[model samples]
Target: MTDAEQQYESSKPLFEKSYPSNGAAEPAGESEPQAADTQQPQFQTDEAFASAQLTLRALVSSKEAGVIIGKQGKNVADLREATGVKAGVSKPVPGVHDRVLSVTGTLEGVAKAYSMAAQTLIDSPPPSASSLSSGTTSIRLLISHNQMGTIIGRQGLKIKSIQDECSVRMVASKEMLPNSTERIVEVQGAAESIRLAVWEIGKCLVEDWQRATGTILYNPQPKEFGSSSSGGGGGGGGYSGPRVRTGNPADFDSPDGADQTQNIAIPADMVGCIIGRGGAKIQEIRRVSGARISIAKQPHDESGERMFTIRGTADENERALFMLYEQLEHEKVRRQMEDQEQDE
Candidate 1:
């Protein structure tokens, strides 16, 4: 983890240090916790100097805890730093709702922090009422190592490009450690917008796929169509098309597909730079922009796992491409730093 990452981790369990006796319990509306799920609230004094108290839930199993904390606490830690709240887990209130998280601080501070955390999540694209549950609409994306440089370009310019161009929330995977395959990129937004971004990502993948597989057949699968869970089935407008096939992923056979896809190519490998170790940096581009992304396979290696594609709507495709450029910008700076270290 980088120094910044370390600082972020030190804070994930923000209220862990100040063990409080009691916290004012607010009646939870309807979002009750299941057998396993934890929520934390942090309380703090109004001043910059005063310490804050945070409370969390033990109901969150270790496996789930890891996600709450995020890769190396990147996501969780980020939640604290961004909102200036100290977060930690707490015991369940005996009679009240088990998920009640206690956060204490300056009434305003606590409220602000709580509000930020809530809105951040609320802003997140929930599962489709029809097919996707409020539980599973969100998806994860990982970039490739070689492609990292292409996304993050010089001095972090490319990623910014994507963000500016599209209406999606894309961020680096905080939990990612150095040289780990699990670099995380979170892409979140409205379902339609997110889907659009995913489609755009797929377009890029088509290019890379063509370069690698010598064909433009690569594509990304949509998140979900009009709602139908394990039981229901029907077709709806805006959600209708072909049944998505994951393994046999296919793209538009129509010749215009290529002309329709591609947005500025990020102008350089700057997009690649942000891709990070195995495309972590650039994965957000695919996610937030709602693009189905894929990198291209190499020729000589002969393994078959390269082409990167992002799938979603038209705006999403454009935004993902723009983000891809931004990733390249981030990657360039990273490489220069590596080169400097090597020279030293």
Candidate 2:
């Protein structure tokens, strides 16, 4: 046998043994059924094992963690129910602003849950300015390796055009994402500029997909694209297509009725960042915003993250959200700088 084939054969047993399985038990008060006359003979082998358990970890920013949890914890609940996996977010590591999301279950369950969580993190929008701030806004987009070339184009022409037209700085990561077949594209500029750059990059990706598959991936209807009659359908009656919804809609408006409640998921490790050294920061926010904030007990199924419920008027809830987001953004920047330093 060739060296590569022999090597693979030698390691086969080791690989199989590494995944220890749960022992099987015979049915109670039951005897083994006898084989039929035409039944094929069964062979005894070590492959006879029960289901194997697996665990995986994913790193996410506090903002992304909130997206994974969803409104009223619906997203995570659905994930568990659909995949039969137990998933939890870890409190922020003592010094890091990022949280570790943990998924554990049978092999199949873990794989499904991990894929769902990874996609959610990849698709989640980066943190944005809650108030009017002239400071540059930085956003990260995860793009698959195959699509990266489309965005970059020959000699980086496409990306250069985007930067020149949108007035935004764009950088693609040199390395592939950890345990993923994607890379990170970082865009920095004013909110509007960033949006323009994203749109252009998306257009490139769509064109590439169409050419490769000979199928139009994004075919907007006449009403959706816009009608010349209504001044290019600039939010006029000419465009009557469905709106593409993004982010948690519940976050946009306050709860109906007198009492308004907003639920926010804070990474366990960074909970301290929000609470401050001695609850000073949280107390200050409550006093100034008049929002009653309380941390809810971690759900049995959720780990590595804590939930906070803020109760008050619409204004108060908005104020609390602003403060929380601002603090998380600061932490994110600090951690990012530290990582860069370590890399250097």
Clashes of each: 101, 8
The lDDT of model 2 is 0.49
Per-residue lDDT tens digits of candidate 1, residues 136-225? Answer: 223334443222222332333333333333344444443332212223333444443343333333222222321211111111112342
**After superposition on all CA atoms, how large is the RMSD of candidate 2?**
26.6
For candidate 2, the per-residue lDDT at 203 reads 48
Writing each residue's lDDT as its tens digit, candidate 2 over 240-317 gives: 221122134564564443457666656565677779988998898788778899875663134445667788777776
* Model 2 misplaced stretches (Cα beyond 4 Å): 1-257, 297-300
Q: Say which candidate scores most in TM-score.
A: 2
Candidate 1: misplaced stretches above 4 Å?
Answer: 1-138, 174-182, 209-344
